[model samples]
Target: MTVVQITLRKKRLGRSLAGDIVLFGLLALVGCFMALPLVFVISNAFKPINEILKFPPDFFVRNPTFTNFYDLYHLLAGSWVPLTRYIYNTFFIAFVGTAGHVIIASMAAYPLAKRKFPGKTFLFTVVVLSLMFSATVTQITNYMTMSWLGFLDTHWAVIIPAIGSSLGLYLMKQYMEQIPDALLEAAEVDGCSEFRIFWSIVMPVVKPAWLTLIIFSFQGLWGAGGAAGSMYIYSEQLKTIDYAFSQILSGGIIRTGPSMAATLLMLSVPILIFIISQSSVIQTMSTSGMKD
Candidate 1:
């Protein structure tokens, strides 16, 4: 309560406040920088074809119009494959693939995280190493495996491989490790079977991890157009909306307006999903490696 102590405390508080202000100001600047592309996409979608193709393209639209969306709708309506069919295929694959990835990855992760077993370290190590390899590196192997399994030209070719994604398994395992061993032991003592403990206890506790995994899996599947569709899907009706939209975008310079509209439509779903699940993702990341 002395004046010196009070003055010193006031100085410390002032410096801390200044630091926090600077930190938050920098974060805001960086956030806006990162958001520019998304804002540009939205702006371009509403722009007239003339603005889109102007000598020097403007970042924002001068005269926004719905003509682009109308053109896109009419073009899709006149396509050989029904627009609804394409939408259905995209949703089916994204949903099924994301669900499968979350379940299978969580199941695989549980044992690797909590159970002691032979080669457990090696197995987890392999999963970690696999993350270093890009999908393009395994493209040929996946194709051959899918062909051997008679999954070629089928939705299974995409869904099955995604279900076994190493990234999801790795993330789930890391999250599960933060669960206390005593908690699981208590569940076992209370007559909970291994599956029951996993489903009832572990899964609920690690919900944020799997929710984050769902976002990753869904985005990947939703955006997959060329690699899976061109290689594995031969039927137009079975092709995803992304593939259909991609075809529209490739229809030369005349289709610019509609292409921009299609681009916006395609980007909207994954962005919405991320926005909804982002809180869970932040929660998972914050405590990912910490133990109870």
Candidate 2:
């Protein structure tokens, strides 16, 4: 190669390496910042009460112990209800809520993504716009409606609303749009029913999308306000793990160590779920809605 070409190539390579180093450094900083809370949760779970209360509390555990977990067990052992009951209630709600939401959202999304129908544009527009409104902003109105429908203090109040969530619908619709229209059209020509096509064809192809939805739905329902709030669920048996965790936190200064343990326990499941399903989520999210 010419001397000028060799020098220019070396300069470009050096600049590229520098840019990469800077980019990765920034990413590492952000990752550490994001991980701080998780590290704190894990480290503090093993810390003693004194360490937790120590001024300028250290982020890492100095001397770890299982006493906190032992104390947490004994504390919950004294509760009016068994700890298993709270766990059961949380899982029941999470599973049912996630299943119902996935089915309904996928069904609704298929029509919006694949069909030409009356009011389709308007309906989809409304769904998109609804995402702008937060639940806290509409809680009063929602509660009033639920009360009028005699859904107050019922599990239905939580499950029904979540089943129709806009986020799930939006994600499913965007992903469904990526499915080739020609395939669906071919299925129709073979006399395949729309419902059959959706269940047997579309649903199978969009595994990544629904897996993403599953992660979202499960995490949301597991930590839902309805599960913990006294207004919607008054029955002790119906209250979830989140409510039990709140009770632990309210146990005051003496139970602070256990409370940190409880927080980590609560966080672990969702973190695991995301870690397991994150590959699918990233793949689908990156390319969804890009098909013509």
Candidate 3:
């Protein structure tokens, strides 16, 4: 190639590279702006009332302390359960709920998506319709059922209902539909049990959906919905993090720093999980509903 031709090619490639760089830089800047509130919460968690309240609150802490953690423990008012127990309860509920959501919901969805069963279409339709319903919308009836089952005052009330979520089932069913019929038939010919095929074949193919469900279940349980049954369960040793935090904030006037500190801790897990997992989740979901 001539010298001028080579120079032109190099100039075009450089300009293309520079444009891509500018595009990614703008996206990163937007991401930072979107994440700024979480940054504020984390900073406030380590700060005192004065710093958190400044006219234009600083993202950097002036005087950080472990006082808020201690202050939270004292809010129990003569209880012996300790703050750690509350964390344990929260973690237990979150872990079990997330696992149950993935396993049970996927199991329930697979047959609906791939197998013929009595009322299968009707069942899927009902589940899809129910996706629009929130727990708060059915609280009165659900609470009554809890009373009937003697589950009203137990952790099971929250855990059990959370496992019944339709959103996970719907998403899983949609993902399951993407798996080829030939794969399931081939597994059966090779003597794989239905459960084994689902575990090894279907589940592997929908890993992105599973990860999304994991993050979602954790996020949802960490929010207000998982705390609804805390009214019945928060008897000292049984309190979840949300109930404990609310009880602490509601008792007369609280110093803003400690309250904000507690709030930050309450919200930290989901924020961190979403930030870490957002990319892979989007990619998986984008491809999950397509035909084989």
Candidate 4:
């Protein structure tokens, strides 16, 4: 190559490298900013009360201790309802709601993705539009519907609504679209029922999407029970972990340290769920191979 071309190429490479460096630096700064509160929560959980409440509020713990966790345990043990009941309620809602949502969303998504039917396009468009609105916007109407169905104050109030989640439906339908139509056609040729094809074929192939949906549904339901839950569930024994944790945190200055520790404990489940599901999600994405 001529020296001019080589110099020009060198200049382009230098500018590109400079731009990338600037981009990553900015990203790193933003990442640190976003991570600061999480770091504070983790560190504060272990910090001695004096250190945590110290002037200027240090970012890192000067003296770490497990006393906060111990205190949190004692506090929970003193509750009228057993801690197990709260835990059970949380897991029941999270697991049952997530399972129902995944199955129902997948079933709805398959036909939307693969089949052509009258009003199918309009139905999907409505689902997409639903995503633009937040659940809180429909609170009054949802409450009336729940009351009408006699689902108020029951676990069904939470699980039933989750089954019709718009985001989950949208994501599953999009993922199902990537699955080969030829595969479904071949299965049909073998006289396989739609349910059989979905359960055995579409499900295994769309593992990533459903795993992702699991993480979303589980996390949401796990920490749910605020407005809707509080309104419906008046029975203390049926209250979720979130309600119990909120009570703990509201215990004022004396309980701040324990509340931080409790927050960490509460945060751990969803983080672990994401970590495990994320690995499977990545694996499924990498291994998904389809022929036209």
Q: Judged by TM-score, which candidate is best? A: 1
Candidate 3 vs candidate 4, TM-score winner: 4
Ten consecutive residues with minimal summed lDDT in candidate 2? 283-292
Tens digit of lDDT per residue, candidate 4, span 1-292?
Answer: 9996899898887777678899999999999999888888899999989987889998999889999999998988899999999899889988999999999999999999999999999999999999998888877777798889999888888888888789999999999999888999999999999899999999999999999999999998888865545777888888887788787668789888998898898888998999999999999888886757
Candidate 2 — which residues are off by over 4 angstroms?
Answer: 1-26, 225-228, 282-292
- In the range 87-171, model 2's lDDT, one tens digit per residue, is 8888887888899999999999999999999999999999999999998776777778788989887777777778878999999
Model 2: colliding residue pairs: none
* Model 1 lDDT per residue over 205-230, tens place: 89888998989999999988556889
The TM-score of candidate 1 is 0.91
Model 2's TM-score against the true structure: 0.86
Which residue pairs in candidate 1 collide? Answer: none
TM-score for all models, in order of appearance: 0.91, 0.86, 0.83, 0.87
- After best superposition, candidate 1 residue 136: deviation in angstroms? 0.9
**Cα lDDT for residue 150, model 3?**
89
Off by over 4 Å in 4: 1-35
What tens digits encode model 3's per-residue C-alpha lDDT throughout 1-292?
9996899998877777679889999999999999888877777888776776787878878899767666765665445667777788788888888888889999998899889989998999999899787777877777787778888666777777778889999999987887899879999999999999989989978888888888889888776433564554646676687777766677654556668777887787887888677887777666655354
Q: Provide the lDDT at 177 for model 1.
A: 91
Q: In candidate 4, how many Å is residue 16 off?
A: 13
